[model samples]
Target: MSKKILISIPIFILAILSPVAPIFYFGLNTKKIDANIQRLLKYSWFDELYSTDKFRHLFFANKHVRKKLSSDIYVKLLSHHKKTQEKFYRFLEKENNRSN
Candidate 1:
């Protein structure tokens, strides 16, 4: 009886938690995925590639893909790029000031 109860308790716990496991997994992975996407977007070639209609149609045509990319992801990538550019300019300014 005790053995059966112990086994059932863990099984019950597992059943309860299984559905939520993906939420936690994806939550942890979201940042890594965002960083990788941002790194890829930082390249000049990526901008050129993305500018082409073929590339945009291939990747962004699907409704789900369009929604995901056009919404938060696009905004986040633009903001990340702006911030990186700002940092670069600041570094350049500091170097110029020091030289002068």
Candidate 2:
């Protein structure tokens, strides 16, 4: 094989695989944490650990922080998503009135 072809092949492969590593790692970690949380949800201290204000803000507290970005940003994203869903659902609701 030519040096140029060999070098380019490795570079292309590396570029394609580079992003997959972190994505796979984070995805697996998230699934494991989810299973652990679900299995432990019945226990009282598990709930307490999640509710404790002191520990809740810490990295290892309530749940495993699974985002590639900061957990705060991830939280904000989830909150926004929830609010948007509420608005969408609210639009479909009908109010009752005594008079026409």
Candidate 3:
């Protein structure tokens, strides 16, 4: 009975592994996925990704992965916007102070 159990376990494992082998093979070839992500970043269709369904879908599909990606993109954009606004306000303030 012990021998029979050992033999049955190997057989069961092999049977399960064979069917799932293709999935492993496909996942191992990750070049396509990397390329797709690169393309998405480089050629962003929307001026702001925050409002796009694709960006929102990415967040919904995988929160942890999307959080890092979204934060980096958002930070850069927000920082640039803040800098521009700061410069504009400084210019206006300087002019106002000069006239006084």
* Predicted structure with the largest TM-score when compared to the true one: 2
Which residue segments of model 1 deviate by more than 4 Å? 39-100
Q: How many residue pairs clash in each candidate?
A: 0, 0, 0
Q: By TM-score, how accurate is candidate 2?
A: 0.33
lDDT per residue (tens digit) for residues 23-91 in model 1: 566433445544544655766655654565544443333333333344455545544676754553354
Model 3: per-residue Cα lDDT over 6-53, one tens digit each = 899989998989887765764322344333345444533322443454
Higher-scoring candidate on lDDT, 1 or 3: 1
Query: lDDT of model 3 at residue 92?
Result: 37
User: Which pairs of residues clash in candidate 3, taking residues 3 or more apart in a chain or in different chains?
Assistant: none
lDDT of each: 0.52, 0.45, 0.47
Off by over 4 Å in 3: 1-5, 16-31, 42-100
lDDT of 3: 0.47
- What TM-scores do the predictions have? 0.33, 0.33, 0.29
